[model samples]
Target: MEQLAEKSKKREFVKHPGLGETGIFHTKADGDPLPDSQLLTFALAGNQNCGKTTLFNQLTGSNQRVGNFPGVTVDRKDGVIKGHANTLVTDLPGIYSMSPYSNEELVTRQFLLQDKPKGIINIVDATNIERNLYLTIQLMELNIPMVLALNMMDEVRENGGSIHINEMENRLGIPVVPIAASKNEGIQELVDHAIHVAKNQERPGRMDFCDPDHDNGAVHRCLHAIIHLIEDHAKRAQIPLRFAASKVAEGDEEILKALNLNQNELELLGHIIQQMEDERGLDHGAAIADMRFKFIKEICDATVVKPKESKEYARSVAIDNVLTGKYTAIPAFVGIMSLVFWLTFGVIGTWLADGLDLGITWLSELVDLGLTAYGINPVVHSLIIDGIFAGVGSVLSFLPIIVTLFFFLSILEDSGYMARVAFVMDKLLRKIGLSGRSIVPMLIGFGCSVPGVMASRTLPSERDRKMTILLTPFMSCSAKLPIYALFTAAFFPRYGALVMIGLYFTGIVTGVVFALLLKGTMFKGEPVPFVMELPNYRMPGFKNVWQLLWDKAKDFITRAFTVIFVATIIIWFLQYFDPRLNAVSDSQDSLLALVSGIIAPIFVPLGFGDWRISTALITGFMAKESVVSTLTVLLGGSTASLSTMFTPFSAIVFLVFTLLYTPCVAAIASVRRELGGKWAVGVAVMQCVIAWVVALFVNLLGIMMGWV
Candidate 1:
């Protein structure tokens, strides 16, 4: 027992790279201590879709984990580089600038200013160096030790562009490493240089963009003057003077407050900023932007060469003409999504699920027979065979469907088609009061709602963030796939693909209506203009696709054994016992039925009113996958048995109710964490009310059409 406790303690102490630990080797296996200076921490930062994440994944492989920033919902991905023992790498949320314009930007900037990682790896997209370098210039001003990781170098080369690496390194006054992160090319060299910079505490030598003496040097002069004024404050606050000066020149209110300057100092700074704007014939923001772009242009001219257009660029342009065209893009997107659903539900996933179901059924029967032969206690036999096996087996059987959906979704994301989907949908979404950026979180919600809700942090506006979080749950996550598969297989087996697609679209349409209502009422505001990059499409790597599929499968399996497994036991116990804990032959006499009976009538208007159905929905609040498990245990784990509880129309209505109801507890917790408890509780109660109304309408409409 002591040894077991020691082993458990050891397991708990295994360093989690994703949480930004250097390593689990402060003390050797033999207990000799190591120096703290040997440990190094580096931050990886870049714009969205710049291959920063891919590089992080390559560096860390399976050693990373996702965590939240201190007070924000943005994800902080941390990992330990393989073969680099004393190094910890933190992957910051992707942001275009270090300015606190959005939560993501604030999170990234706060980490750099406060936590002060040993070094920075500013990943720049080689194909779009001009825009990417804008953020790089900001990082350089932070005065941190940094390396330029020019990712997607292969794409740049293939597009007939070339970068003079030596010239770039000399010009930036930092090491330049060209890497195609997706292909795992030049990654080791990049890491080596980054570690060298961190260990030596090497800061960038050149921070000035436009020289103060240049012809159009108003912005530069103002920046330098502000740096001198705020030098003491910046030093006291442990912020880089150059960064603080730039923000001050840009008239950032947050920087002004943080500096806590006196009224006289504030008036003097305002006068200087206004004078600079007058001299530059632009606003402070524009003046700063113009200077940055001017510097970027100069750097590109010196180090970057663009050759004739390549075949891949031409192909992508030709494809985008239709894929993002005004008339065809929506139809193409819908058709593509429909095909994804068909492949998942009607063909590959369904076939695989059938085999798994049979295996689970056979295993259950074998367990039952073995227990009977051994004369196991009847109650124990029921608990093992009927409770655990029936419940967990039902959820596990839908693993293929979840994996298949995620596989295709990951392919779309990797191929760059998903970005185009956002672009195409931006116009329609605007009418419904959301920008295309909202779609990123909604699409992610299809995989899981927790990250989906957290992804809303990327929105620049609080209203958009809250609204996106509210609508995210309507996307029907993969966890709900088991419930859909179960019902479709039982009731609409012949048209399974069409039915599944309809359910997804129903969720989407429901979200759109609610978004319109919210936009017109409580959250009255126009969506900010949508701006996003469309990366060149490439064939997704098989390894990357497999990795994503494996992640989805692992998460699904883990939940089945943990949350769902425990919930099943509790539910089974409740269904098998009375209030006094005495075994009850009939479930109607059990505590679960009596408790669920109160709420069962609320769903009566939606066609499913049985205590068993109500119990499933209650357990579903714990985890959506539990809905299928609860039904399997209560209905004897057979489609035929489930069929006796509802007609075809009523089954469809029940599926609708499940689709539109409040998300599971984990997602609600995420919502609370991101948007506060009031919003979280409001979302839960609102979803329940909406689901009831929508299901009631569907049931009434179906009955009027004589479909039931």
Candidate 2:
């Protein structure tokens, strides 16, 4: 062990990728040193739902949404450590391994290899140590400074399991700190160890997990021969020999391309791997994985005391019997969502929103009286009372409803039920050329389509990502809640919750139908296999639920003030003024109505032919909330006025249009970023066309059934 430590000490790889071997890192990619080099960055990594994000929140005190399901952190997020501005921690997307099979794993691998962080803070689920350590084994090959955070230690101890931290640390040639991330236990020590190793450039002492005496030395001999053969190529590619060699042995095409190996060298390497696989009685990838697991088993045998299954698992199994049962899962999902909508629209949220609306209306009337008494300019009074208050305040009242819905969703997420939803959805998603993994993004879409679009990046298949992005806009985002709230209150007050649930279900069904069509035409292939961990269910933590609620509230409030605010102001100005800049008492003769009149004819067949309604729907592209605020201002801030704009049948058609129409600009931008401009344009055009056709179909059907 001492001799291996000496060897590791002698080898000094670059702290930052594509930089000098010196421990000092520079600020710029050009490798020029700067004072900013003092900033030390570490990577927070772990398998999904292993409490990696809980530790990130503890370390940085930043609330980056932490859900028990995978793909929550689909992209990298960096934060400064609490009380340590000089140290930064980047929470990487959850990944199972370094293999570039999935997009998240590939992104993590590229980041580690190309934009190397100084150290890795590898958090592992101590209760499920064997599976978590598989990733840890791969990370050790990077040869960077790392500290193993044995997370969920409290759970392990409660379940009668224990780990010999010092022994495991010594065996793995890295520091191991026991921690309960959720409880913020042992985090300081983990931070101190990470900072110390990074500053001191402490690489892993052991690079050789395979013992030469094992398997009659077949695996050992093959690894050493390939390492020697590719030593120069690995160095030329600026990759650690250990990692490059392992990837080469596993036939990773990306690593092979990076190594730029010549034909002869490749052939020789293949022959050595083939010989090893023959002797080991396995394929190359299996042989390598078997060897690594064998090493992990030995280490666990020596240092880990396996625990009895905990009550959490027992409860999860009991819950799964109903939640994920073949015949019951879908019905349970529908019932749960129905209940959430009922509470949000029919009872709690609606009551709170009504109270808020009354308060706002009182305030608005008071302002109106003050302006009239003071003889304020009519235009200025309208901007403040009708524009800002009527517009922004109208959407603001829905905040409680949005937050309440997210609250229930977050509980489902933190309790680990979301993972079961994905598992149960795999079969259905596959039929539409998607996997259960696509459900994460789709679920996120219900909150907002931007992150939902971004979450598609976690999908490995391009076909699935594109289809998921296309379908997300149909998943009735919370932004459209105001539209539903407005119409339901004006048209279907007693059936608000039922109507809301029906709208959401309709959006989902419409998306599924389109997805099936796209599968057969645009993306003709099956979805990739869906493999994910089902975390043991536990009570939702207050912190996680609060953080999610706060995030939703903050995002909604910001957009209401920013995008929706500007949009409402512009809409009010256009509605009240003619093209010659003259204020008009009648909005129908105003500039906004005249312009929207051009599009009004197109929707005449769908039943909403009014220019004011057309203008509101058009403004919704800027912000979906704008549809509510614009309509409120244009209709003179009275919900009762909405009744005269459309009959009940026409209102349902309008709701259907809004539910299936293109998402706001932010979501489209996300799609453009992911799939490029053409796909973004296609998605927008496709959604609008589908929405019109569906609305028209509903209108025609209602007439046929004598329900119009």
TM-scores of the models, in the given order?
0.90, 0.94
lDDT at 442 for candidate 1?
88
Worst 10 residues of 2 by lDDT: 19-28
Per-residue accuracy of model 1 over 578-609 as CA lDDT, tens digit each: 99999999989999998999989988888888
What are the RMSD figures for all models against the true structure?
9.3, 4.8
Specify the highest-lDDT model's number.
Answer: 2
Q: Which regions in candidate 2 have their CA more than 4 angstroms from the true location?
A: 1-6, 9-37
In candidate 2, what are the lDDT values of residues 86-153, reduced to their tens digit?
99899998898899888888888988998888889999999989989999989988987787889999
Screening candidate 1 with a backbone cut-off below 3 angstroms (N, C-alpha, C), the clashing residue pairs are: 18-65, 18-78
Which residue ranges in model 1 land beyond 4 Å of their true spot? Answer: 1-38, 62-73, 216-220, 579-582
In angstroms, the error of model 2 at 302 is 1.1
